[model samples]
Target: MVTKKLYYQDQYIRNFTARLQKSGRDEQDRFYLVLDETAFYPTGGGQPHDTGTLNGMKVHDVEEIEGEIRHYIDVPAEVHKEYTGELDWDRRFDHMQQHMGQHILSAAFEEEYGYRTVSFHLGTETCSIDLEIEYLSDEEMSLVEKTANKVVMENRPVETRWVSEEELSNFPLRKEVSVSTDIRLVNIADFDYNGCGGTHPDSTGQVSSIKMLHWEKQKKKKIRVYFVCGIRVQKQLQKKHKVIQDLTDTLSAPQEELNETATRVLLLNKELEKKNNDLKMELIEYEADSYIEKANVQADRKIVREIFTNRPMPELQQLAKRITAKTDRILVLLINEKDDKLQLVCSRSEDAEINMNDLVNHVLPVINGKGGGNNSIAQGGGERTISAEQLMDELVDHVKKISGT
Candidate 1:
């Protein structure tokens, strides 16, 4: 059985009475009803479906299946009876504005620069159209936007009518229709004429305004243009204004100077960071010199072992490197305790006999640690089941055993 599409008869039909002819569960186990007639718009042609209430039951999804529009609902309604259907007018009008705005915007590009829109999508927050060209400059997009808004402001009458295949040749259509028999055309005064099966406003002015948000390159030779229309444009502006106001309060700068002040502050931070790092390096060097003066002599090399509190592994490695670099035959072992974790760094001079990697490998297992390096340097960390001083005692004993002193 065929269901009469009430929307095509009158897009403004918000409330209607339709009797259900079929009702069943779909493959998804979703309960649905197929009415003898419906005003609900199904999901198709880049436009989403309409949602409302059927018999006061929330109709969450409306879809066309096998030439029938199914109104999917949360609860099943009485079958074979006339039920009141209410369309969410707010949502329906939003789609109408976006759909109409898209036609105008797409025509603007084709008219000005001969770029055809390859595809279109109507999203909840914004809509997009894919252009056939590989790139579109911001300046070009702005010009197209200006042209589209001009048409909108003109408030040109948008005409829609059914036409036969042979009759289609009579008008200057932007593109050919997909279906031949039940073909419909949407014409914007003298601007554009295209085949479409979506609901649209009677006048271009109802679109309110069209604003191009941004564009990015799609696949090989296509670019996707993102834009918003009507109330969406205002919502985008309000959100951005809130962010700017918060930033102005935090940075103590006017909106006009936010960018300049932010850039200057970032540069200042970088300079200060470099200065602090240089001071840290100088302090590490002084600590290294002090360790060298207190080192103990073993067989033929000096042993410098120290435990630190809340020190970083990088600084520990730098301190060990400085100590070994200043003397020819010295072994440097450093460990740092921060909270409950320990970090170890061991290194040796070019002539030192002990293999630092082997030494670290041998003792780190005691604290369930893990790390490895070359024969000269090694570092790793594990839990602090043992104190830093106890780990130091273990390292010194192993060094004596390795050196046979």
Candidate 2:
């Protein structure tokens, strides 16, 4: 037998008694109990399922399986003739507020701008309504929010009625219903009429208020609007206020002056960063000149090889480039040791008769690393298995062998 949905009968039914019609375990061995009647709302249509206690056992999830509403739990319930099902009122009420608020905001958008809501998602923190239109400006969104809040303040009655296919033509439906039979429509005073199976409040005022947070364009010329309602709106406000208050204290400015203060600080930081970069470049040039002044000639090629402790790889590469640029007969082999890692840089002047990639290939295996480059410059490194001095010695010797002297 189908479980009688007591929630649709009376949305405020927190506690009820029902008979255990069936009980079994799924493929995953999760125990589930079906009842003759229940107030638990199953998960469907983007609204999450109701969670509460069934016969004192925690009901974590509820879903419809073959016309029966199964209350999935960790443990099976006691086989009593009459079982007690208690709804978690706080969670139920929060969902009610959000669902009802979505209806109002969606109707307002349609009523004002003809933007029909194509989708709705009731999330733990926020609710989103995907509209049929693509672009929605801030001012346009603000107007819709104002209209929705007006409906909430009006305290319009929220009514529901199940009508037949012939009776459907009598009312102004916002869109077509999903089911032809057992068609239920939620009516909001003289404003909105739409098909929905979700729970809602008795009046629009219970939704408290509707605030549009943001909106974005979707793939198919649709716009998704994110918003909060009732309790969530208050929570969102509190969170934002705390952030603003923290910023004011940190910047030593008032709330109204925080933006200006932040912009000024960012500009000052940019200027300081530019000056630091200029100083670093100046030091790199001086270091390059010192390395180039002392050179060893091997087979008529000036070889500049050095091992740097705790030096950056990029700076070493730049130094190698500077040295090679000064003379056509120069070959530069550089190794930098940073922390536990070692890096090597190899480069040569244009007229130098050697492919640098070959030198890098010979040394990469020694450090257990990988690298790739063209004939002009090649570099690679891995773990610091050996000291920078030892790595440099091996690299220079390989270059000497390539020189064939």
- Best candidate according to lDDT: 1
Residue 321, candidate 2: C-alpha displacement in angstroms = 3.8
Please write out the lDDT profile of model 2 over residues 103-163, one tens digit for every residue.
Answer: 9998999899998998999999988999988699988998999999999999999998889
Model 1: CA > 4 A from native = 1-3, 76-78, 283-405
- Quote each prediction's TM-score: 0.78, 0.89
The residue pairs found clashing in candidate 1 are: none
Number of clashes in every candidate structure?
0, 0
Model 1, residue 265: distance off in Å is 2.3
What's the lDDT for candidate 1? 0.92
